[model samples]
Target: MSLLDFDADQLAAFAAEVRQDYDVLKDKDLKLDLTRGKPAAEQLDLADALLELPGKGNHHAADGTDVRNYGNLAGLADVRGIWAELLGVELEQIYAGDSSSLNIMFDLVSWAYAFGTNDSERPWKDEETVKWICPVPGYDRHFTITEKFGFEMISVPMLEDGPDLNAIQELVKDPQVKGMWVVPVFSNPTGVTTSEEIARGLAEMETAAPDFRIVWDNAYAVHTLTDEFPPVHDVLGFAEAAGNPNRFWYLTSTSKITHAGAGVSFFASSVDNLDWYKSVASVRGIGPNKVNQLAHARYFGDADGVREVMRKHADILAPKFTKVLEILEERLGQYEVARWTEPKGGYFISLDVIDGTASRVVELAKEAGIALTGAGSSFPLKQDPNNRNIRLAPSLPPVAEVTAAMDGVATCVLLAAVEKLGA
Candidate 1:
């Protein structure tokens, strides 16, 4: 039965029982973390062959450019082409860079702030106030970037299909709303894939800001948990068809695919947008890390190679996800105090606890030596209006650890919910 069905005495009894369970959890002196979605050591080991890749004299790219020396700002065609095919964009439309798609995103925002985008009448810094649309229970890092730049982040509810289009369309009517962030496929935490209908709506929406760019961060486009991978949507094409050819800025990286800190990043958009970015990028540095890009190229010979490696990752990851879901269901099912997304892809599972108890749940978990992503982290400025929503990252921990951590977490959830009820 739902916890709501419990009377005061019954709820207090249950709370006492849950507190005993929590005491036992703390007694175990366990130190388990579910903070960030880092690849497990075993998952990293799958790409160990990359260490000796592009060995010695194999320094030249297929285009006859020496990767050892500087200046292929566009990166190696072999690697670029591989991602191009995988991302469903043309090779020339995409450019590869050293790891960290976040860095590329930062530069784009920074550059726009300093020099303005191709369509910007003036640099963003000149604006009276720059606002950004953020999908709630979205990626924290994405919000961090805009927050750091002092942009007023407006939160929109993330529906099952995607970010609320009706809300976004209304928000963008303001000229100061410069851009928005989107993890198009298997979005962080929520795992809500942007339906093609939503994708087209975003691309075609009439934003007052002529240069209203959408940061299409497809971080988990290929990181599937099932046998079937989600399709890479033609977002740029959607923009082009809508007469806004440069409406979206596409980005992806092999950080999770290969070595997290030593993989290649990619950017794709209109030819004009690509050239404009390079114009700014050219002044910043000589080129990207071609040697490392070539090494990645050698590691994943082509697009299929990436899929094969991801499959190996799925093999290791699927069970951990299943375990987490099983624990959440088994422990919290009867009470109905919580509900979590059973994601098909992506690195996180979003959990919604009883309103006003998420922070308490996280606190209880921490006191019991379990680390979870901070409560309200999925919202703008670290504020969840309802004080619910927790992002659970199961990718970093082993299956056994995931089980223990989740069980302990469930106890905290129940305890917090009961405490909120009885108080």
Candidate 2:
């Protein structure tokens, strides 16, 4: 019988039984972790060619600039050309940078607080307070960056299409709202793509803060599980045509496409915005690691090479995701005590447990020898108001282990729901 269909007394009894079973299970002490979203060792091995890239001797860029020496603060032109094709942007509009796209984001935020973007004259720090709109069931790392800088984060509810446009529109009317972080394609945890209509709407929104920008971090742009996944509409172009030339700042990386620590990252925006960014970034460093850029240029010969490599990733990730989905369906589908996303692409499946029970279920799973990303991690400041969301990363585990882990997770959900319902 489904846990949701149970009467109060039946649920209570079930909870008691689960508690007793958990105690016994804990004694065996098996160890398994499904916490971080790191790629498996096998996945990392797929990019072995990148290790010997740029060959043993060639270390100069297409423009005759020595990669080992420092000069081009924006990055090598050939590297920018590579990302231009990948990001569907013009070569002049793309900037290839260091390993961390997160570093570029931090710089943008710092600039907004210190010097301001093209449209606004005053620095954000000049104000008494600054606010940012964060779509809930979002990426924890995204929220961490904003919160660390002391921005008042307002939670915007997420729907299957994307973040609620009504909420975002309403919130942006406040001058205090400076920016919003978006993962438009295969969003973190939820795996929902932002709709074209909402993307356009976001670009056209009438904002009180003239310097407001959309932090478009498309981290999983090429990481799809299926061949039929939808195309990502270009928000940068949409915004420009809608009369806001500098409305969006898009960032992406080859972290999953190649080596995580060694991959190159890309940033794209309008020409005006690029000029402003270069003026500030020039003071930061001489330039990004050119040798790494040269290596990626060699490894990905052209745009098509990137597509060929991504297809390989899909082959490996598809089975793991399928196994987790099947296990969840077999064990928990009938319960109605939880609902989960059936994503076509992306790194995670977001599961919503009964209200007030997500944390308890995660705790229960841990006792039975499983580790999960802490409950509430999908929300700002790690707070899910309803306490019902849990992000499950199934990509790192092998198919057999993914099956076993989902089975354990389903049991914990039912047991926790029963306890919360006082059955």
Candidate 3:
């Protein structure tokens, strides 16, 4: 029988049994973390080339600019060219920004609030209350950024294809709705891809605020586990075709691909947006770390080189992801109390338990020494009204440990679901 229709009482009993087993199996009082979606030590080994600078002997860019000296506010042309190839945009349209994409995102918000985009008339901060559409079961960090800036975040529903376009169209009609955050490829925690139809709809959408943009953070663009990965629809091209050239602010980084804290990030947009961003970024700093950009350019010479690197990551990650899925199937699949996403190429597996039981399940897991991303973190303002979504990051731990942790999580889920039903 499917987990959705299993007997709650039977599931409860199994949970108790599993908890007993876990208690006995684990002897040491070791503190293990599965809260953050960080790369494991083995995964970090894949970026060893980045440790040494590529052109220490030679320091000039293709445009005759010194790589060591910092003056290219828009970043080195070759680095931008490489990132553009990876992001599927024109070379002139890409901006090789600093190490953090988050910083770039922050700057975009600042610019929109203060000066507004070229297409829009009024600044967002001048409005009574600015708002943003945050698809539910999304990246927590995205929501955090919006919340920090005091934007009223409206939670839009997310499906396998992407954010509900019907809701998005309706929300954008309100002048307060400025933007939406999307992780189109193997989205965080859910590991689902947005459909082409939704991509087209978003590109073609009409908003009361002309400055309405989609913050497309493709952090896992190249991190796929399977051979048949979903292709990212060319949203920028679609938007331009639909006469909405300024509708997207695409951001990506080699953080997960290389080093988390020290990787170069890229921003892609229309020529208009690029010019606006460059003018604003000039005031912020001279330029991002060219040495790091050179390192990335050397490591992944082109789009094909990045793909080759991702294949290595898949080798390490695929087995771990499969192990977690298998353990979850063996333990909770029989119970029918929850359902989960079987992602082909992302760092997360999203599990949905019976409504209102997520917090209890997470609490139980914590008591048993297994930590998880908070229950409501997937939603805006840390509020999941149904309290049903749970993000499982299985990549950080070793295979054996991941298996054990998943088993522990299953026990907690079953226990919580059964108790909720009993009450």
Candidate 4:
């Protein structure tokens, strides 16, 4: 019977039983983590060949620019061409940067703050109150970046397909709202992909800020857990058609596609946006690691090579994600105390415990020696109004460890719900 179906005395009895199980779990002293979605060691090993690449005395780029020395501020034309194909853009529009895509993103936004984009009349900092719209249950780091820059963060609901467009259309009325953050495909936690309608709507929507931008973070463009290769909507193309050619700043990385730490990051925009980005980038540093960029070029000869690499990652990751789903269903399916996303691709499973019990569930799991992402981490400022969301990352650990941690997690969920009902 359901906990809600029980009378006061019965609820009390169930709570006592759950408490006993909790005590037993505590005695076991288990230690496991399901925090961030870090690529597993096996996934990183796929790009190990890049280490010995660009063989000695062969540092000449396809354009004849020696990568060992500094120059090509926009990156080697050959590497840019490879990245342009991956990003679905013209070669001149994309700029390959250092290992971290987040670094490139940070620099872009920082430049917007300091100097603004081509569309803006003045720097973003000139505004009395700059803000950004963020889809909730998003990547926490995105919110942190905007928040750190003193941009007021506004949360918009994330729906089955993507963000609620109605909310975004309304939020952009404020000229102070400079832009929004989007994961585009295989989004973090929920794994929500921007549909054609949603993508088109976002690109064409009118905004008060002429400089309003779409931080199009296509972090998982090619990451598919299933066999189907979903097509990416050409946001840049759509925006250009909408007469908003300079409205988007596209970003991507080889972080998950190749080596996590050593991967090259990329950004693509319009001709004007290109001038803005490269101009700012030139002042910040000389150039990205063209040597590593060259190594990546050789490793992934073309877009097809990237697809093959992701296939290998899916082969290693799909089973672990499946195992997590299986454990969640077996242990908690009957109770209905919790529900979780069965993501098709991307790095995490977004789980929602009974309202008011999420934080307690994580607390109980911690005492049992399992560390889950803090409850509400999926929301902006790490605040979930109902305290119901928890993100589970199965990629970092082996399948067996994922199983063990999830089992304990389910137990904690049930116990927390029962205790709450009894109280």
Index of the highest-lDDT prediction:
1
Error of 3 at 353 (Å): 1.0
Clash count, one per candidate = 0, 2, 1, 0
Off by over 4 Å in 1: none
Q: Model-by-model lDDT, in order?
A: 0.93, 0.86, 0.83, 0.87
- Candidate 1 lDDT (Cα, 0 to 1): 0.93
TM-score of each: 0.99, 0.96, 0.94, 0.97
Worst 10 residues of 1 by lDDT: 414-423
**lDDT tens string, model 4, 1-423?**
655777888877777877787788788788899998899999999999988998898798897888999877778776788878777789988888878878877877888998988888999989898989999889898888897898898999888888889999999998999999998888888988889999999999999999999899989888889876667888889999999999988988889877887888888888889898878778878888899889999888888888888899999999999998998888788777888888789898889888998999999999899999998887778899999998999999998888888888888998989877764
| lDDT digits (tens) for residues 233-313 of candidate 1 | 899888999999999999999989898999999999999999999999999999999989888999999999999999999
In angstroms, the error of model 2 at 118 is 2.5
RMSD of each: 0.8, 1.7, 2.1, 1.5
lDDT of 4 at 60: 87
Q: Give residue 162's error in model 2 in angstroms.
A: 1.1
Which rank order by lDDT, best down to worst? 1, 4, 2, 3
Better of 1 and 3 by lDDT: 1
Candidate 2 weakest ten by summed lDDT: 21-30
For candidate 3, the TM-score is: 0.94
